[model samples]
Structure formats: structure tokens, C-alpha cells
Target: MNEVMDYKFVSKETTVNEMIRGKMRNIKVITIGVLEESTGIVYPHPISEFIKRQYEFYGKSL
Candidate 1:
């Protein structure tokens, strides 16, 4: 028999920096959740529209 376990997805983010020309710059980061089931493993799931909209409300940019 196969046992099923519930998995919880935790979302996290970090700022990435790079130096170009002579100044440092930050880049935007995006992420998505992955799904796995008895059928197959999905590399990624669609990003949430709500999350995308939240970016617009941010007080500052990375």
C-alpha cells in the first residue's frame, strides 16, 4: 500500500545583486510552486495572480 502525506509549500524570496559597468544593480525575482502526484511530477505551477498584483503595492523596489 502507498501512504499519502500532505506537503506544505513555504514561499521565500531574496534579492540578487550584480555589478555592471561600475555600479551595483538589483534584479527582480519570481517563483512558482511545483506539484507532484502519482501521475507525474510537474516542474512548476502557475504563479498566483494575487501575488503578482501585490508587487505593485510594494513601497520600494529591491
Candidate 2:
């Protein structure tokens, strides 16, 4: 989502918001619904935690 949102980071027709709506939203579904059920990874955490980690990573990129 951050990459898609950045004009310089990635040049694409879709905005970050559009990618969030069209693509990124399913990340939680896939993580919690399928991957967790199969692999038992900790990615099944709360969405807020994921957003926090994204912001943390983005902060590092800056």
C-alpha cells in the first residue's frame, strides 16, 4: 500500500487508496483465513498491529 501510494516509489495507474480497496484488504483475509489455518503464522494478528508495522517500516525507509 505504501509503495503503491508513493508517486516516486512506484509509478502505477492505481492510487494507494485504490490498491487498498482492490488489493491490500484481502491480505488480512488470506493471512487469517488461509495461511493461519494452514501454517499457523503470527501474521493473523490484529489489523491495527499490521498497520503499525507498516508505519514502522515506512518510517525506516524515510
Candidate 3:
């Protein structure tokens, strides 16, 4: 089976305390996605490992 999982990374220019202090700053955010494959409709932890392995395999190919 084929599936996809979404992951996100966020960066804040100011700390929460700074924000509370009324400091204005720009916030940056980044997002990434990883496709997960499974043998069945439900994805188990083992299947997630498989996806990681696939990535490692292709990464080494480079």
C-alpha cells in the first residue's frame, strides 16, 4: 500500500516571553512531507520503519 505522512518544522524569531513583552518579530515556518508505504490499509510502526529504510536505501544510492 501507499500512503503519505506530513511533517512540519517551525521557527520563531522571538521567544514567547518576548512576544508577551509586546515585541514584534517575523515568524518563519517550514513544512516537509514523507510518503509512507504499508502492506495493509492500516499502517503499523513496523511499516513506518520500512519507509525509513527505503529512504536510507535511496539516500545511499546518491
TM-scores of the candidates are 0.29, 0.20, 0.21
After superposition on all C-alphas, the RMSD of every candidate to the true structure, in Å, is: 6.5, 15.4, 13.8
> lDDT tens digits, residues 1-62, model 3?
22234322222222222242587665332222232323222222343345545774575310
The order by descending TM-score is 1, 3, 2
Clashing pairs in 2: none
Misplaced by over 4 Å in model 3 are: 1-44, 60-62
Model 2: number of clashes? 0
Candidate 2 lDDT, tens digit per residue, 15-54?
Answer: 1222554575322212221133233333333543465467
Worst 10-residue lDDT window for candidate 2 reads 9-18
**Cα lDDT of model 1 by residue, 1-62, tens digit:** 24344333333353557686899998554545443444444443445345656664686332
User: Model 3, residue 17: displacement in angstroms?
Assistant: 31
Which scores higher on lDDT, 1 or 3? 1
User: What C-alpha lDDT does candidate 1 achieve relative to the native structure?
Assistant: 0.49
Better of 1 and 3 by TM-score: 1
Error of 2 at 60 (Å): 9.6
Local error of candidate 1 at residue 12 (angstroms): 10
